[model samples]
Every structure is written in C-alpha cells, then in structure tokens.
Target: MAIDILVVDDEEMIRWTLKEALESEGYNVRAFENGRDFLAYFNEHGSDIILLDVRLPDSNGLDLLLEVTRVDPDAIVVIMTAYGDVETAVNAMKRGAFDYLAKPYSLEEVSLLINKIVQANLLKSQLHHYQEMLENKFSRILGENQKMKQLREHIGMAARTDRTTVLIRGESGTGKELVARQIHFQSARADKPFIDVNAAAVSSTLLESELFGHEKGAFTDAQKQKKGLFELANGGTLFLDEIGDLDPSLQVKLLRVLQERKFRRVGGTSDIHVDVRIISATNADLEKAIEDGRLRQDLFYRLNVFTVNLPPLRERRDDILLLAKNFLEEFRKEFSKDISGFRDDTLRILEGYSYPGNVRELRNIIERATLLETGNLIRPASLPDELKKSSDLGYVAFSQETAKPWQSTGFNFKDYIDSVEKQIVTEVMHEVEGKKSRAAEVLGLTRFALRHQLKKHNLESD
Candidate 1:
C-alpha cells in the first residue's frame, strides 16, 4: 500500500509544497489548512504519517499532538516548527513526535523525510504481518476436555483487558507458548506486535540489553543505538518464555518496568517510558526458585496478577484419541495417502501408552505412521517399539521353551525358523489389523527390524 501522509500545516504555500513533493514521490498525500479539519478527518479515517505545524491557527499545537497520541499511541508524527523554534521542535519529539521540519526548508528536505517515513512504515507492515499470521495460526485451540473448556474461559476473560500481566505455567511441550499467543492475538492490542523472547536462550550479560535497548557505544558490540524487546513491543505484548532463568540484576530491572512502566536503556540517562503488556511463561517452579535465591518474591507477585497453569497431556487423556485421529487424518491428506482409518485395536494401542512428550509427541507419531503407510488401515506394525514394548509389560503368558511349541514339520532347520517367524509376524499383524508400527512394538522390536523379518520370511505383501 502507498504511504498515506497527512500534512496539517496552516500556511497555504507550505501545505501545497508538501502535498506536491510527497505526491511526486508516489505517496498518497492529504493536506489540511487547520487542525480542526485534520483532527475530524483523523477520527473518521486514520493516516500513516502526520505533519502538524507547531503553531496552528485553530488549536494549540502541543495539545493537538497530545490528542493525536491519545487516539493512536503508536502514531507517527513530525512537528513543523519555525527555524528559530528548534528547541520547541526537540520538545515535540519528547512528546512522541517522530521528528521536526524547520520552516524555509527546501523541497529536497520534504523528500528525505518521506523516505524515512516510508522505511518505517515498511517495518510496521512486516510486524503487522507477523502478528496476523500468529493470531491466525492459533485462532482456536483444539480440545473438548473439561480442562480445555476452563482454559478457554480464562483466556476469554484475560483477553478482554488490554494490559494485564499474565504468568503462564506449564510443563515443557504443554502448549504454554500457544496459550500466550492466543491471549495476545485475542486481546484489544491484537493489531500491534507480539514479541517473543526466551530468557534462557541469551546470556545474562546480554539479556538485559536485549530486553531494554542500549545507546551507541554502550558496550563493545554496541556499534549503534538499538531498541530492546520492551521498546519494540510498546503498545503490544511481550511473551517472555523461560522467565525463571532471568538473572537477579535483570529481574530487578524487569520489576521496575512492570511497576513504573519506565526504564533507561543501557548506558543511557533518560528514562524511556513504554506501555508493554508482559506475558511470562516457564516450566520451572518459581516458588522453589525464589527460596533458592533464583527468583525474587516481589517480582513474582507483580507478574502473578493472573496465573495460567496448563494441564499436561497425561492428565488430559480424554483428548488423546480425538487429537490422534485428527492428526492422523491431517497427515494422511498432507502425504496424499489412501490409508482409510485406524483399526479398533490400533486406537486401543494408541490410548494404552503414556505420552511422555505430550501432544507434540502424539502428533509426531501420527505423522510418521501416516508417512509410512502402504496399506488400507493403520495396524499395530505402524507404532514405535517403545510403545509396544511398554504396552506388553507383565503379559508373558508362557515361555516358548516350557510351553507347547510348534513341532518341526520338516527336517530343514532354516525353513522351520522362517515359518515360525512368518506365523508370529502375521498373527501380530492380524491382532492389530495390519498396523505396522504397533505390531513392531508388541513384538519387542523396531519397525525396521520387523519389516526385515517379514521380508526374510516371504511374509511381506506384494
């Protein structure tokens, strides 16, 4: 989309010059003679960038700047000031103006400012795309279990508010990040950015600077000014994962930002204020960490305004087969396979095993099974060895040596062994209705190992 520039300069010549200059550069430009008409137009239709004269005929320029921000806190504004009023221009920047253009400036100056505004808009566009994609990806959480029902209710209430600090607790792979993303995308600030930062991923020395930007030459690698996640996530959500890994010093800094909503960048003196909604997640026990001097109790209280604890997959077993079948069908379509469905025995095998890796692991199992399917139904042979072996625990009905074993029908030893192998493999396959992964599991062998035995015994389907 073309950059929409709103020029609110009072002088007829200035507005005309800006309109012509910006339009010549392929921008959509609108010029107003006074602040009243511009503010009214803004209420109806918003613009990408605004150029307001510091001394307007119909309104106080500073008051207009304040009102513009109140309408859109992330509004990009450039104040137009007289050459002698440079100090006032600086003050306007402090009041959230992007920059200032001095009067008597050439048309070339207008072109330069437009280029800068265009570049900034491009960045905003990228951020908006990312936000939209995430919100769309997790638009709905899949589960009909009672736990999931309660979780949905909590998310609805939390998203209604704009700036509530949310602390999400869940075991790893329990969809904690998904919950956080849902809250951000469902909230009033969904149009803004959702910046995710893993606290444990960065070193303590650099984590502070990464969260709160640093000035130029702040550190050895600080070659230029940088904005931290907090600054970039202004008017948006900051999803801090593994938050228990935060160091003590950074924890103090974070507490200050949560309480005062302001902080100084690294090696900077000025307090940069921001409006950021913090959503922190961690698998670690914060209470134990606090007792061990790893987490501060006060910071915990500030962030614990609302707590969301996610149930693990083991605890939510009712959703297991539902999720598994859904994943199976999805992978079937993705791989373009003709596998009809899971056998009843196959579903029993799937439900019997404990999923230590949770929903993520279950999805992976289904995907692998779907990709390897070469038959009508997903049988026991399609399952992993770990699951089958674990499922067969405590079920050694008899020892082959002690119990009645199949007598040799012929004198050839190799032929008899091959016949026994074929019989056992075929029986296991029939038991689970041809699910290869599950059959391999039940026989205490890998799918690869079972397939080799099948081929060696001439039991493989043509």
Candidate 2:
C-alpha cells in the first residue's frame, strides 16, 4: 500500500509542490493550508507521516505536533522551517517531530527524506513480525502441572537478568536447549547472537579450537585465523551444552575465562576479551564428576549460579496429552495433513507406556504418526509397536517362555499388557454406558485422571 503523507503548509506553492512530488512517488498525499484544516482532515482520516510547516497562521506547529502525537503515539511528523531556526527545529523535534526540514531545500532532498521514513516504517513492521514468529516457534514450554508452573517462574526470573550464568540440568530429550534459548530470547541480550556448542558432539582435541578460535597456522588444519563462539556471541549469550563432558584441559581454560572474562585462543597467545552470558547444560551429574576428578570444582560453582532441572515426561503425566496436541498442530501444518486427533486405542497406548526418552521421544512419535496418518485422526495402527505394547513401564522382563535373547527371535510381553489394559478399560466404559463419572467411581480413579485415560484410549466419545 502507498504510505499516506499529510502536508500542512500555509503557502499554496509549498503545499502544491510537496503534494505533487509525493504523489508522483506513489504516496497518498493530502495538503492543508493551516493546522486547523489539517486537524479537521486527520480526525476523519489516517495518515502514516505528516509534513507540517513550523509557523502556521492560526496555530503553532509544535502545539499541533503534540496534539497529533497524543491522539496517536506512533504518529510520524516532520517540522519544516526557514533558515537560522535550527534551534527551533531542534525544539520541535523534542516536541515529538520525526525530523526537521530547513526551507530552501531542493525537491530531491524532500524525496530522499520521505523515502527514508517509508523505509524505516517498513523495517519496523518486518521486525515486529519476525519477533512474533520467534515467540510462536520457541515459546512452547507447555505444561499445566505444578512443577511446570514453578519452572516457568524460574525461567521468568532468569530471563529478566542481564548477566547471570545459568546451568540447566536435565536428561537427554528433556528440552534443555529449549530452556536455554527461552532465557536468551527473553533477556536484555535478546537481540544479540545465541551461540551453542556441545562438548560431547565434538572431538576433545578440536573442541578448544572450535570454542576459543585460533590464529593462522595454529594447527595443521588452521589455514586462517578464526573467531570462537565467545567472539561470535560477544554482547550476547554463549550456550555450552554437555558442559560436564568438556575435556580436562579445556576445563582449566574455561575456568580462567569465567573468572577473568578473557581467554587466549587455542595456539594463540593474545588474550581475547568478551562480554558473554554463559548458559551451560549437562545431562551428567557435575557434583559426581567433580568428585571423580572429571569436572573442575571451581567451574561447577561458577556455572551453577542458577540451576534449572527439567522433569522427565513420564513424571509429568498431565502434560503428555498437552504436548502431544502441541506437536500434532505443529506437524499438521508442516505436513499439510488434516489429522485431527488420536484414536481411542492409540491414546491408551500412549498414556500407558512410560516414555523413557521423555518429551523429545513423544514429539518424534507424533511426527511419525502424523506423516503416516491417512485418516483424520491417529489410530493404534499408526503407532509404533513399542508404543502399543503393555509393558510394566520399563518392559524389563523379557519373554521367559522364549528362553533368553539368544533363543527368542520374536516374543513380546508389552503386547499382552496392552491388550489386557485396553480390554479392561473398554469393558468398564461399556458397563458405565460411556459415563466417565460412573466409570471413574467403579475403577477407583479420579475424574481428572479418568478423562486423560479415556482420551488416551480413544474412548472420549463413548
């Protein structure tokens, strides 16, 4: 859409010149002879930018600027005045003008100034949209349980700070990285870069170079000077994942940096300083590692300033369906599928089994089911065999009937448990005439829990 610009000048020549020039540049330009006329028109219509003469016959342009700004906080107004009124122009700017234009300026200068305003507004709009997208994508720390609520409070507190180092401890697949990112994106350093490195993923020999950079010819593969994650995340955040796995040699260097806010590059003598908020995550027990001489004691104390521990999905059963639905909606859009929800059998299976892999596993299961779904909802047929198996949570008991792992090629105990549980739930629901309240009373379960079970078993409709 063409940006609407209102030009208010008492001189007929000045008003006509701006209106014609801006209109030629594809703006919806309107001209007024005085502040009164401009205010009258603006009351009924909306404009993106305003070009007003500082001296109006009926009103002071500064007063008019204040009025427009009061009406619309985001209003953009530029003041126009004769030469030697730079001070007045500056004062007008203090009164909320977007800019000041000196009189006797060429038409080309006018066009350039207007173009800059339009581009700035465009950039602002794009930035707002981008931030919204990031929030939607990364802000899904879903849970209705008390533990989750407490976790959210801690996250809020951590995100409000500027430079507190954070330590996130959780089992693999528990979304430690997600927690780290939420903290970074919500803090004062949100607009800065968020760099992450995994101690376990990279080789111990190369981890230092990767994290601390190196000078030209620092090593055989160091063809040129390179910047480390610290430099890349300067004035931002650096996430050190699997911090417990950091090699002992690197641990000393890391401690030095944490203490002094400086480091010497791998094979480089010059000390590099950085202002980085370190957020470290580890699935390992740093305390035990410290005792075992694996992790440095001082480093653990430094990084453990604020610790956040995420619960396993099985422990937070209330969030299973919640997370499943979230993943469902995400995959629905990603795969462009019409899949609505899970079927009765599928829900029971999902709820009954203990997710040893936690939330990440559930998401992967849902993703796979979504892609394989041919109907409007996911069913037991769409679920993996392991999910449908009725194991004693751990499924640790192998088939005694089939001898051991060597003798049996195919045997499953989880299948038997699943069928038995499904049958019992199905028959109970039938006996209650599909009444959840009556079923819960007979089965010795709470209505809240019964509802989740019913949904898991695709017995909600019943």
Candidate 3:
C-alpha cells in the first residue's frame, strides 16, 4: 500500500513543489490551493499524511488540525509554519500535529520528517494487524449446544464491562485460558495488554514476586526494580490461571488490590495505583476450598463477581462432531493434506469415546488422525487404540486379554473381524517393543506383510 500524502497550501508554487517532490518518492500526492478545497477532498477520501499550512487563506491551520484530530484521532498531520511563528508550531504539536515544518525549509528536511512519520506509522500498522489476528483467533467459541450458546452470551455480558472481575470454572483441558482471552479481546481494553500466569506453576515465594514485583534489593535475589503483571497490564487485563492455588499470604494482598485498586511492592513503602481487570480461572471447586479453609471467602467474593462455568465435553455430547470437524479443517490446511472429511465409522469412534481430557484431547485425536490418514477421508484405522476399544461399533465387548468376543445385538461381523486383527497386530508389536523384524519372525510372517499390517492398523509410527 502506497502512502497517500495531502499537501494543503495557498501558495501554488509550494503546493507544486511538494507534490512533485513527494510523488518522486513513490507517494500518492494530492495538492489543494486553500483550506476549503483540502477539506472537500479530505471529507471524501482520507490521506495517510497531511501537510497543512499554518496560515490558510480561508481558515486557521490550528483549527483545521483540531477538526482533523476529532474526525480521525490517528491522523498524522505536519504543520507548515513560518520561521517567525515557532511558538505556533509548538502549539500545533500540543494539539496533536505529528510535527512541524518551517517556511524556507529545504526539501531534504521535509523528506526526513516524512520518513520518520512513515516509520512510526508502519509500526502502528503492524501492531494493529497483530491485535486483529488475536481477536479473530479468540473470538471463535465453536459449539451449537444450548449451554455453549448461553455461555457465549455470558461472555458477551462479561466483556461489556471493564471493572468486573471474572471467574472461569472448568476442567483442566477445557480451555479456561481461552475463555479469559475471549473476554479480554472482546472488551473495551482490546488494544491493551493481556498478561497471564499460572498460580500453581510457581512456588509461593516466587509467585508473590511474580504477581507483585519487589523493590530494588528487596530480597537476596532482588537486585533491580521490576514491574509486576498487575502493573504491566495496567488499563488491560491480568489472567490468573489456577487461582485456587494462590497462597494465603498473597491472597490478602490480592484482595487489597482488588478492593482498593492499589498495592505496594514486596518491600516498597509507596502505594502504586493501577486500573487492571483481573480474570481468574481454576479447575478446583472454590466453594469446597472455602469450606476447607484453603481459599479466603472475602477474596473469593471479590474474584467471583462474574462467573462463567464451562461444560465438560461429556455433558455436551452433541458438539463432539462439530468440534471434531472444525479441528479437522484446521489441521488439513496446517498439514497441507487432502483429507476431505471423516468416514462414517471414524465419526462413530470419535463420537462414542468419553474425552476425559475434554476438547484438548479431541483436538489431539483429530490432529493425529489427520497426519496418519493416507486416504481422502479420516478412517477408524487412524484412531488411537483407546478410542477403538471403547467405540460402540461392536468392539467394546471384545476382550483382548482373554481372547473372548461377546455376542451382542446389532453386532457387525466385518467390524468384529477387523478389531480382532488390529488387536493381534497391536499386541504382537507391543510384545516385541515395536521391533518389526523380530515381531514378523514371532508371528511367522514376512517383513513386508508385517509392514503392511502395521500400516493398515495405523501403528506404523509406533
């Protein structure tokens, strides 16, 4: 994208000089003779950079700068002033002008100022692009289940306000951090920082210093001053994962910060005020913790202002296939594979299994299947052994240890035979510790035939 430069000066020679000079630098330059003509063009098509003469024939350049800033707060305007009116140029900068150019200024000076502005704008553009990508990534909460629909509504309500503390309750792999990100990206503080830390991942002493930084020489290891997550996330959000594991000593300090919106460093005397939204998540039951005296009731009250309870995967079985398909598409593009979809038998296996690890485990399953699948569609052969063992496709009653196949209603003979063959190959490979040549000799089969069997059962990687 070429930078568009708008030159607004009453003098025809000045306008012509700027247009020719900037155009030679590969910029899209447009010139106007007066403020009225410039305003007309600007109202229709905005420019990336503006050069406004301080003394326009129709209007004051300062007033025009205010109007431009009011319309577009990000507008980069450089004030063109006379050498005698240096104070006016300074005032222009205070009023949001990017910089100033004095009359009798050389074209070289103008080029240098424009280059600086271009570099600054380039950085801002990149940051904005990255922020947009983050928002897009976290905004997707995929599900069609009723609970999921209501959960989305709850997330929206939580995002509508900036002061409310959010508590996300879910199992370990159920995306508690993901919900925290969604709240942060959807809120008014979307452009600000979103910092997170796991309360249980660090020791109590270190976690204290991590959340509320220490003063210089505050302790034996505190050699220099450092900013904490709360201070770093000022005007943004700080997500505390596994909040239930926060130490009791730190809980008192955190409660003070939440109640008063202020805190002091570990050994510092001065109080530091901050405006940060705290979003805490945990897999433990806070009510139980409070009863057991592990969690402070007051702190729990403060953190639980807005609660979002995520449903476990087993509770919302209808969304299993929906999430599976979404992950399949994601991995397809990522792996550059031509997998069109999941086979019917594969879908049965996927939908039948109980995901103890929830959505995270399901994603891993699909990712592994997508990589191992050799055909146009994901087949049951690509699934893990656990899923096959528990699948409702007539394999659940077959006992590998006893070599017994129990007969049941709606049992498919072909699937039963395939399961038996897969189990035998799996057991033989496991017995030999995945040494294919030795396993082939034990099974009285050729090496090529063993390799073929392993591929058929999707155990080639093992």
Q: Alpha carbon lDDT of residue 157, candidate 1?
A: 82
What's the true lDDT of residue 375 in model 3?
Answer: 94
lDDT tens digits by residue: candidate 3, 1-462: 358999999899999998877765557899987888888889888889999998988999999999888888989999998754768978999999999888889999998898778656654654575567565542268899999999999999999998999999998788888788788878998767777899999999998888888776788976556557787677789999999999999999999999999999878899999999999999987999999999999999999999999988867877888899889988999899999998766776676566768899999999999999999999888999877774543333443421233334345677766666776776577557689899999989999999998887677982
* Count of steric clashes across candidates, in order: 17, 7, 0
Give a tens-digit lDDT track for model 1, residues 1-462. 357889997789888888876765446889998889999999889888998888888897778999999999988898887754867887898889988888778888877786666556655774676566555432346788999899999888889888889999987777888788788878888767678899999999888888998876788977656667787778789999999999999999999999999999898899999999999999888999999999999999988899888887767766877888778777888899998788655665566455657778888888888887789788768988666543321121133322121231223455434444555676577556578899999999998999998877566776
User: Sort by TM-score, best first: what order?
Assistant: 3, 1, 2
The regions of model 2 sitting more than 4 angstroms off are 1-139, 390-462
Rank ordering of all candidates by lDDT, starting from the highest: 3, 2, 1
Candidate 1, residue 399: lDDT: 31
lDDT of each: 0.78, 0.80, 0.83
Error of 2 at 300 (Å): 0.5
Q: What TM-score, computed on C-alpha atoms, does each candidate reach?
A: 0.60, 0.59, 0.60
The TM-score that candidate 1 achieves is 0.60
Q: Which candidate, 1 or 2, would have the higher TM-score against the true structure?
A: 1
In TM-score terms, candidate 2 sits at 0.59
